[model samples]
Each structure stands twice: as structure tokens, then as C-alpha cells.
Target: MLAMIEDRALHTDLALERPVPALQAISHDPSLRTTVALRDGRRLTGVQAQWAYLEQAAAWVDDRFGADADADTVEVLQRWESVLTRLERDPMECAREARLGRQAALLNGFRDREGLPWDAPRLGLIDLQYSDVRPEKGLYHRLLARDRIERVVTDAQAADAVEQPPEDTRAYFRGRCLAKYGQDVAAASWDSVIFDLPGRDSLQRVPMLEPLRGGRDSVGDLIDASDTAADLMAALAAR
Candidate 1:
């Protein structure tokens, strides 16, 4: 779930954004148990319970947004209804559809809140666990545990990252904000931060959603030359 949230934060480019949807599918002995955690933090257990929650959310959207609701919002509710209709006929299909439909609804809800377009790329599903491994013998376990310490990012790099946006991504722009305005100003802004440049009709807002595009060598020169966040942004923009 944490990975999912991070992915959403880094990749969602549409004007709309929302918290990661909460849906857990646990494999039981003979069936799968589905759980839905609502935005209010209420957990709905069982297929029936989840369906009921969707129904309420759909109704609430209609009541709250009324004529202002977008087509995606309406479609999400309709999709839920269709999934519910299939519950008795095909339980498996119903479960699959319910998950997809609920995800769409959750994302669209963000669009409703911000009055933004729904054109961002949909999130791809990621498997969080591996299932084929069996317990090893004591000797095998000891051998495996020998090399348990793994270091992906060095401590120095992580410390630099706190103040400098990654040069390979849009985060470089965000780093500029932090550099110019200080941490408090940058931390308070989200999605995009507006800047009052000279030529624009209105303030320019820089989005921080683009993923890292640099390789090991891509940001080397910029990192070496940069003494401040502003310098880093300028070097990255020049690149």
C-alpha cells in the first residue's frame, strides 16, 4: 500500500489526484476474502458489505455534485451497479469487476473535488508478495541469512536528496521551490506550485509528478556543480 501511494504521488499527472484506494484481497482456503477500507477509515468486510458501501458512495456523489458531476463519476456508479448485478450469476467475475469499478470511483472522486480532467494514466497493478517459496532447512536458512543486509541508496545520497530534488525528474523543479522559499513554503504546497514569472498571463505552476529519468551518469555533472538548489534547477533545465 505504501508503494502504491508513492507511485500514485510520483506518476499521476492529471489535474485530479486522490489518496490510494484501499482494497485488500486475501486468499483463504477455498475462496478470497475482499475488504474495502473507505476514505473515512471504515473497513467493509465481505462482498456484500463492500457493495453496500459503494452504493452509498455513489448516492452521496449524486447528491453532493448534482449537475456538476462529470461523466466519469456517473460511469463509475453505473459500473458498480453492473458489477452488483453479476454477483449472483458469477461470483468471481463480480469480485473482479467490483475491484475495478471501485478503483475508478475513488480516482474520479478526486476529479469531482478539484474539477479537474480525468486523463491521467491509470495505475498498473503490482503484486506485493511471492507465494512459491517454502521453508528451508536450518543450513539453507543460515546460508540465506548471511547476506541479509541490503543497501540500495547510500546515506550521503539520501541526505542530499532531502534538500535537492532529483535532477532526472520534475522533482528538480520542486527543489527550486524549496530552495527559493525555504522548506516551510515548499512543504505546504502540493501537486503543483505556482510561480510569478515575468511573461506569463498568470503564475506558472510546476508539477512534481514526473518519475526519475536520469541514469547514474545523467546528473553527475549537475550534482558536482550545484552548491544550491537554484543552481541545480538551472543546470537541469539547461540539460
Candidate 2:
């Protein structure tokens, strides 16, 4: 906890001129690679395809941004790359991340499309994927553990009371609010009616928000944080 605060204190946002030269450089590179072969005489371009896409990483990214935009975009893209590197480990970590990520998406997608609240009971895809792994062992166990971390990370800024709580107890608290807010966060701020949810069969009470107001801002923040949280969780789980 102390370390996280220190790291946060030392954090600095990179300032770049819009429209960095990344795309231009990528454009200049000949984006191509030799396809590979497969066993059983099955010829597949897996390696070549991967390399080809890697070579064109900056192509799909718009390069017409102004100087400031370019720099900011590049920084965002670099951070995204770092995140991908963290998640792209062995199959075990990938599976867990995939589960956690899909769950986040399932919840967040409602905010983007339904014009509705992010209620909890509407599990849908997340529940389906989660349900298929009933016997929580092997990959599912890792995924469950990862889910706990995901829940923890989603609750960044949980509360800084310990000898060093998480880097931001608020972030974690926000996550707790998000998970508990059900589906009414589009109108009011969570702070308006936050309370503790009943524990699971006599467990300690966990803080939860009654309704997540200021839905736009808070949901957006949760999604952004969840993005990096997914990567970080996958990496740590792998280790």
C-alpha cells in the first residue's frame, strides 16, 4: 500500500505533440512477412500473419491527428501495448483474462448499448461463461482467483486505512460501488446512497452503492481502469 502510493506520487503523464511520427514511420516500412508451414502437410500462415499484423500495428490508427493528438495517441497506444504484453502469456493466464475481460465487457456493454442501468442480475454472457466452469478447478480456478483480483482492482481506491492500503482505496471502492449499484447509475452519484451489502451467509459486510449516479463518468472510469486491471491481473496470475 505504501509502495503503491509512492508509485502513484511519482507517476507522470507523458505530453506529446499531436500527430506523432509513428504512423509515418510505419507507413514507410514494408509491411509483409513470410508465411509459415504446418504439420500434416497443412500449410498455415500463422507466424507470417502475426508478423504482418505486428508490422502494421500503426496503420489502423489514424495518423491525421494534430501534433498534440498524435503524441497523446502514441502514449495511449504504447500503454495499450504494455498491457497486451502483460496479458499475452501462456494459455492459462489468457483463459483467466479472457473470462474476466468478457465479464467486464458484458457488464459495460449494457452501459454502451441498452440505454439502461448496469444491474447485477443481468449476468448474460458473463454468467454463461462463468457458469460453464462450475467445478472451479484448473483454468477456472485461476480465472476465479483472477476474478477476485479483478474485483479488487475494479475497486481501486478501496480506502486508505491500512499500513498501506491499495494504491487507491477509492478505485476499489468505486468498483465495489459499480458492482453493487445494480443498474441505476445513469442518474445519480454513488456517493448519494452508498451502503454495505449483506455478507454471504454471515460473512463481513461489504460496502456497496445503492445506485450509481453520474453513470457516464463513473462507468467510463471503471471501464478505463478495468482495462489496465485486466492486464495487470493476468500478468500477476501468470507469475
Candidate 3:
């Protein structure tokens, strides 16, 4: 079922990567539109794209689980549906509800995985995940969230990321590999790409995990000021 959904997403107008920017662009320019196909064979556009996907997911949950789903899963799905319904009415409340619901779902997953008692006080996990909601904890929370629900990257940055590598981390090295090797990069496994540096005697292997630590390694000012691969490499090397 997961594979089927993923296949559909690949073929449909589902902007899975950097979706916030895509939605924003669609809102501003009709020419930059995207559509999502509904279960009824109807294609919804603009702001409806995300909602349609959520509705489809909800439908899948209902169809698969029906009345036999565990209590925790059913409760989480109910909350998700409620949040979706509130999208047209109270978006702020909807966001808050969704967060709480996600926290609940995460707790349930953790409990099941660890074989912990269901009644255990796992709300502390939310704080551990999101930290305190203070300004000082903003970066921590953003780093933890990453591509989940966080908007760590700006819309412009997200848009550019689709085509070019982020010029603020080790991803720049991967981009350099792509530029130098072109189609040869694909010959390397999907997990890591090997690059032969101009001056280095040995081939360098760039891992796909490079960008994951960028938030911790990159200085805000340096990332903002970086305009070249050299700048990013210098910043990363400094760290």
C-alpha cells in the first residue's frame, strides 16, 4: 500500500520535495500550477492540492483498517481528519491540533516499539523532540524537524535546492561531483558518489548524509554569505 501511494505520487502532480515553495508559487502564479488527482478521478489545483492528498490518505487508512484498527491509530487518524476539516475554518487551530496529534502518534509508535506500557507518561518525549518552545530552542527544534513540519529553509532556498546543491554545506561537494563527473556520478551507488579531485591523488567519496548535519555545522552568517562552493567548503572545514 505504501509503495502504491509512492508510485502514484511519483506520477501525479504531488510536489513531495519542497512542497511549501511549490504551493506558494502556485498561489502567486497561475502559470506555475500543480494538480492532484482525487479518488474520484478529479484533479484539484492550487491550495486544494495538499488537502486532496490528505483526504486520500485518510481514505486509505479507513479502507485498510476499517473497524479493526488499534485504538491509538484510530485516535490519531480521527484527529488528522478533524484537523483537515478545520483547514477551511480555523487554520491556526488546525496547525496546533495537528502538532498535538502528531505527538500522540509518535508516542504510540515509541511505546509499541519499546514494549512499554501504554499508560506511561510519554508527553516528555514531545519536549525531548520539540524541546521547550522558547526562542533559544528554535534552532534545536528546526534541526530536529528538518524536512518534516519545519520550514528551516526559505522558499527561495527550497526552490533552488530542486536544481542546484545548497551552497552552505557538504552538499556543495556533491554538486561539485555532479558538475565534474556528469553522468559518471550515476555509476557510483545511490548512497555515495565518488569524485576525483583536480589536485588530489585519491578519489573522494561524498556521502548522501552530508547535508543532514548542515544545520549544526553551518554558521548562519557564513551560510547566508556563501556564494561559491569554495565558501561552503571553507565553512564546513572550519567546523
Candidate 4:
């Protein structure tokens, strides 16, 4: 397993070294070939892009463990070293990304705190309007009751809360309303994104990227674990 993780890390390193200017080229990048995008319209800086590459690689490495394996599994704990190698390839990348992130954050904070650049894109959000496509409101109501969601949401602001929410419980019952009516719904759902370009009153819809988030390291971990498991299995089978 460790060896497998090492191999994937090597590949990621190779990808980083053999840089293609276009972020789109990542789709063709050898190993996982998975896609990532910042919460839809979000763009990543040089460092964020680099970290995201390793993070996903780490996630794939970790995911290789058997279902029963706990986080404490010897294999899981040891995987950190593999992750270290991948991220440490160029420590400056981390620092660089951190600096960029902080700068952006500071700028945003100033915008909010001091109210500078009212003309700047003012923390736009995709205001998803719920459509009735839930199974039943019971389960959804139960889930949405959590503080994280309830804090921002008010009463069922969408269609008549169906007795049974749409087949897709999470989507059909987002903050007590479905943004879209459909049988298949995923909790990892975002309604038609409303992008408020700077200087626009009404939010406009724009193309959202796949993978609502970027830079999750689960994929890298899983890949490493799978490689380890496969090697062990292969060796055992050969014997």
C-alpha cells in the first residue's frame, strides 16, 4: 500500500513538474484524471491549483483501504508520510498558495470591514430557488433542522412542501424546499447558480464546474491505499 501511494505521488510530482499552462489539461493528466472546480465560478490561484492536485492525489491514496478499516488502521496512519512526500515536493508552493489566499481574504475582509470597492464583486452567491421535487418533507425537514442550514434558511420558501419529498431527499428538501423537481437528487446539490457579476443587479446563471469543491485530499489517500492493497493481493495471489 505504501509503495502504491509512493507511485501515485511520483505521478503527481511528474504532473506538477511537467506543467501545462492550461488548467483544463488536468483532465488529461495521467493518474486519477478526475476533474475539479471551485464552487462553480471560483478560480484558483497558482498555489491553490497545486495543492488541490496533491490533495486529490492523497484522497485517492487513502480510499484504497478495505471498508472495515478504521482511520486508526495501521495503514491509514502511515499514509501520512506518503502524503508528506507529495506535498513537500516544493514547500514554497504551499507558502505561495497561503500567501495568495491570505491576500484575497484580506482584500475581501477590507471590502467588507472598510467597505472599499463597493464596485468589486461583492461576495456573490448562487441563490438557489427550490422547486418541489422532494420525496417527503419529513426526512428532509429532519436533516435541514441542523444549525448550519437552518441559520440561513427561513420557512419552506418554495412549492407546497409535498407530504413525501422528491425521490431525491437532499435536493428536493434543501433548507426546506427543492430547487429543482427530480427523482434523482444528491445532497451535494447546488441549484441553478446565480452569479452576480460586478455592476449587475440581477444574478445571471453561469457554467458551474464539476466537483463543487477543489483540493480535497481524499482521492490521493484512496489511490495510495488501493495501490497498497492491490500489490499485497497480487503478491499473495502469485504465491
Best by lDDT: 3
lDDT of 4: 0.37
Q: Please give the lDDT score at residue 39 for candidate 2.
A: 32
Tens digits of per-residue lDDT, candidate 3, 45-92, equal 644665655666656667667888778667656765665566445444
For each candidate in the order shown, give its overall lDDT on alpha carbons: 0.48, 0.39, 0.53, 0.37
Model 1 lDDT on a 0 to 1 scale = 0.48
In model 4, the worst 10-residue window by lDDT is: 123-132
As a whole number from 0 to 100, the lDDT of residue 174 in candidate 3 is 54
Residue 177 of model 1 has an lDDT of: 52
Query: Which portions of model 4 miss their true places by more than 4 Å?
Result: 1-14, 17-64, 72-106, 115-239
| Worst ten in a row by lDDT for model 2 | 10-19
Misplaced by over 4 Å in model 2 are 1-51, 59-63, 70-76, 83-89, 93-96, 100-239
**What is candidate 4's lDDT per residue for 1-239, written digit by digit as tens?**
35556555443332333334445554433232334444444444444465655565456546764455555554444543443443345332222222222234434565778676645553231001112235353323333444212222235634344443333222222322222311122223354323233444554442224333211231222223433323322332453
Instruction: Provide the lDDT at 67 for model 4.
Output: 57
